[model samples]
Target: MGTGTGRKFLFVLGSARRDGNTEQLARLAAEQLGDVEQRWLWLGDVPLADYRDVRYPVSERPEPTGNEELLLDATLEATDIVIASPTYWYSVSSSTKRYLDHWSNWERVPGFVEAMAGKHLWAVTALAEEPHQAGALLDALERAAVYLKMTWRGGLVGVGNRPGDVLSDTTALTTAKTFFTA
Candidate 1:
C-alpha cells in the first residue's frame, strides 16, 4: 500500500512442473497481500543459467544484472518479509536451492541485509503422501533461512494430486492467511 517504501514481497517459486502444487501455494499466499507489489520469479523459467559470476561476495560487491539487481534491489526494498516456497523433493527442490544459492552473499548488495535483517520468512512445501513427508525439506529450509539471517516465521504442509491440488485444502488457505498476518 505504501509505495514510499519496503512493503512488498519477492516470491520465488521452486517447482518446474507448471501449475504444480507449489505454484498454487505461492499464489494463494500472494493473493493475501492485496495490491502489494510482487516479483514472482519461477525458478523453472530461469533454469539456473550460468553467469559471469555471482557478484554477491562477502568481501567485494559488483554491479548486478537487471534480474539479479532487481531481485536484490527489491529484496532491499521489501518491507514485510521474503517468502520462498517450493515442492519438497528428497529435501527442498533443486530449483529453490539453486535460487537461494544465488542469494548467498549478504555483504555485497547494499542494504540487502538491513532490509531483510530481522524480517520473517515463511516456507511451504508440498510432499508425497507419506509419514513426515516433508521432514528433510523443512530442515533444509530452516537451515537456509538461518544462514540467510532471516527470521524463520513458520511453515506450511500440503499434499494432493499434483501441483495445484493444494488449493482445495482448507488448511492451505488458512495457513496462508496466518502467515500473511504475521
Candidate 2:
C-alpha cells in the first residue's frame, strides 16, 4: 500500500464530538491514501488559546509552546494537510476557525510561510443539509490555501447530522474511496 513518495499527511480534526460524522468521513478518505504517513490531531485535545491580534502593536511574535508547538511542528512536517471539520451554520466549526487563526501567528515565524508554500490542502466536512451547504466551509479552506500558495485539492462533503449518519451517504462513501488519490 505504500505510495513510496515520502508524502506525510496531517489530518486536523476540528469536531467537538469524538468520532463524529466529519471525523468518520475523513477516516474513510484517509484509508485510501495507502501506506503514506498520516498523523491525526484533534483540536479539542490540544486546546489553543484565543489568538490575539498582535500585528496592530507590531510586537515580536513569541515562540509557540505547549500544544501550540506540537501543532506547529506537525503542520510543518506534513506535505499534505487535511482539515476535517463539521459544517456549523454553513461554515467551519469554532475550533477549526481558532486553529486557522493561529496560522497568523505561525506566519510571523521565520520561513514559516515559505515552508507552507506549495503544500497541499484538503478539506472534509459533514453537513446537516445538502452537500451544497458546505460551500462556505470549502470556500474558506480554498481561500486559505490560495493565500498560503498551497495546492487546493478540493473537498469531500458528506450529508449528515446525527452520529454515524454520514456513513449512510453513499455519494460521500464513493467519493471517499478516491478523494486523496487526486
Candidate 3:
C-alpha cells in the first residue's frame, strides 16, 4: 500500500532485550514508510500470560488483566500490522508466540474474524545466522495470516548477532527501503 497519513502501521516487536537487533530492523523499516502514522508496541513490556480462552462463563473467566484488550484494540485499529521478533532456536521469540497464541481468544469476540479479514500482515525477524535459519518462524507467521484471512505482505530478516550488527547488512537495509517506499 502507498505510504500516506491515511494508512496506519502497527509494529509489534517481540525481542526480549531493549534496543535489540529485531527492534532496530523494525524501526528502519518503519522509517521508510513515509507519511504514515506508526505505533510501536514492545511485547517485552506487555505482561502476557499463558493463553486462556476468555470467552468462558464468568466463573471460568480468565483474570481481567487489560493487556490483551489493549493489544487487540491497537491491532484492529491499524491497516497494516508488522510482527517483528528475534529468532530463538528456529522458532519465534517467546513474546511473539504468546501474543500470537492469544489470537484464539479473539475467535470468541463478535466480529473479530470479520475485522481481521483483508488486513495486511508483515513479518520482520533478525537472527545471528542467515535468514534461512528463521524459516520456521516465517512460516508460522505466514500461516497465521492466512488462517486469519489477512494478506501476507512478506517479511525481512537481518543477520545481526551483536547490537547494531544489522546496520552492516546492505541487503536488509535496501530491502526495507524499497519495500516500504513502494
Candidate 4:
C-alpha cells in the first residue's frame, strides 16, 4: 500500500545464494511494508563489475555499463533504501561491497548529491552467529547515508546459519515488523 507520503523502497539483496537465510529475512520484512512500491535487486543475478575510472580532461559522466546502473535509476525514485546482505568475514558480502563501490561514479552526476538529499536508508542482514556480528557492515551503511545527506532508519540483523534459521528468530521478525511502522 502507498504510505500517503509517497514513499518507495529499494531493496538491494547481496546474498549470492537463492532462498538463503538472508533472503528469507529480507522478504519477511518487506512484506510488512504492505503494497508500497518496492524494487528488489538481487545482486546474485546482476553483473556488478568493478569500477574503473578513466580520467578525462573535461568533466564527463562515467558511463555505467553494468547492473549498478539499474540500481542507480531505482534509487533516484525511491524514498527509502534497504541494503540487505549476508555477513562475510564480519563485513558485507563481496557483491554488496562491489555495489557500494559504484557510488563514486554516481557522485559525479550533476545534482546527484542534491537528489539523494533527505532520502531514508535502512539495512537488513543475516549472520551465521549472533546478530551483533553484522555491526561493521551496518556502520558502513550508516556512514554512507550520512555522507549522502540521507536519514539512517536503523537496521535489522537476524541470527541464521541455515536456510530457514532466520524464521525462528522472533526477535528479528518482531523488529522487522516495527522498523518502518515505528
The candidate that wins on TM-score is 2
Residue 106 lDDT, candidate 2, scale 0-100: 88
Query: Considering lDDT, which of the candidate structures 1 and 2 is the better prediction for this target?
Result: 2
lDDT by residue for model 2 over 64-119, one digit each (tens)? 89998999999999999999999999899898898899999888877889999999
lDDT (Cα, tens digit) per residue for candidate 4, span 45-111 = 8867776554342266566655766777877888898888888899888888887877767777667
Tell me the lDDT of candidate 4. 0.83
Q: How well is each residue in 1-182 modelled by candidate 1, as lDDT tens digits?
A: 33454556767667757667766776777776777677776766656544334463545555566566655565566554444555455576776665566675534566765556676676766655652677777677677668667777666777666646677777777887655655
What C-alpha lDDT, on a 0 to 100 scale, does residue 105 get in candidate 3? 75
Looking at model 2, residue 23 earns an lDDT score of 98
In candidate 1, the residue pairs with backbone N, CA or C atoms under 3 Å apart (3 or more residues apart, or in different chains) clash, namely 6-79, 20-163, 21-163
TM-scores, one per candidate: 0.74, 0.96, 0.91, 0.92
The pairs that clash in candidate 4 are 1-35, 1-36
Model 1 quality (TM-score): 0.74
Candidate that would win on lDDT: 2
> Which pairs of residues collide in model 3?
none
Q: Who is ahead in lDDT, 1 or 4? A: 4
